[model samples]
Target: MEDAVGYRLRRAQLAVFQQFNEAFAAKDLRPTDFAVLLLLSCNQGLKQSEVAEALGIQRANFVAIVDGLEEKGLVERRKSEKDRRVQALYTTRAGSDYLKELMPIWAEHEERLIARLGGTRERDQLIHLLKRLCD
Candidate 1:
């Protein structure tokens, strides 16, 4: 083999990340930040801990991420109506609007990546293998 799996994966990650960084820079969103917003869009009113767990992010680190999104007016942290002690996360109107714009761009980006990987079939195979590794 010309290279090991880890080396190839790292190189591919770096290449895609560079493209992602450039694509989102104009929108003032990093990939990590985008993940949080996207999560909130799909799971409205999710508890802080739930978001952290779903994202595999440390609770402490996730707080800073949520706080930043709150500061940006992209998301809000509100006291849960059902649980006085828990704060639920939700995307703001502005956040939803941003997502409306970003989703198409995201789709295009994903398509480009899938093409680079060879096609939909190859991309599917890659995802299947990657999921096995992750598990």
Candidate 2:
């Protein structure tokens, strides 16, 4: 009675992300925000275009993400020293601290994902196959 593939997959995806959303709610951060912060922490002073490219997000859509991060006081965009017209993005001190606090929870979430899907290899293959379907 409950075997529709679309329903199952959508529910599974929502369940996984809902766990993440709950874990980071205290910091008022979304998964994408956590990703952006982590990326900036590792690749300090990256350009917005580079972030957009890495995330596979279009420039227009990325504006909303940037605005959210800025409003949360998690990141700042500044004029690039070499190219005044280009803006470089950097995570703020609060962002770094928030990431530090959430790192363990993120790790646990990854473990839960693997457990839910059997194992990492199985999950990876599932994702690869799903991606091909989209293609």
Candidate 3:
């Protein structure tokens, strides 16, 4: 069981998420919340469906996530001028500022993980392998 790749990956994911939860506990953010804010920050004006698809989130589940962020003032949905039927997502100014504050914490978290994985070379290799698996 210890040698099984899937089991190992699941365990690693749990540990990483546990660390993440601890680090962001004060801010009351979850991994998925951070991901949505980050994505909106990078790509403004993306339709809800587009964002959901890109994040590999189901539309139904994605709506509740967006609603929560919206209530928190971290994200906003705007009617697309080009398509009235579609709603585009954007990170609020507060969201951008929040991300700026979170950046250092995020960096520290990543550095810790990278160090645990034996530095940049190993980190890069891990990412590459992970990407291959994802693809």
- TM-scores for every candidate against the unseen true structure: 0.92, 0.79, 0.97
97: Cα error in model 1, Å:
0.6
Q: Predictions ranked by TM-score, top down? A: 3, 1, 2
Q: Which 10 residues in a row give candidate 3 its minimum summed lDDT? A: 33-42
After superposing candidate 2, which stretches have Cα over 4 Å from the reference? 1-11, 127-135
Candidate number achieving the greatest TM-score relative to the actual structure = 3
Model with the higher lDDT, candidate 1 or 2: 1
Query: Each candidate's root-mean-square deviation in Å?
Result: 1.5, 2.7, 0.8
Across 14-112, the per-residue lDDT of candidate 1 in tens digits comes to 999888887777887888788888988989999999999988899999999988888888999999999989999999999899888888878888988
lDDT of each: 0.89, 0.87, 0.94
Query: Compared with the true structure, what per-residue lDDT tens digits does model 3 show for residues 27-129?
Result: 9999999999888888999999999999999999999999999999989999998999999999999989999999899999999999999999999999998
| Candidate 1 ranges with C-alpha deviation above 4 Å | none
Query: Residue 37 error for model 3, in Å?
Result: 0.7
lDDT of 1 at 1: 39
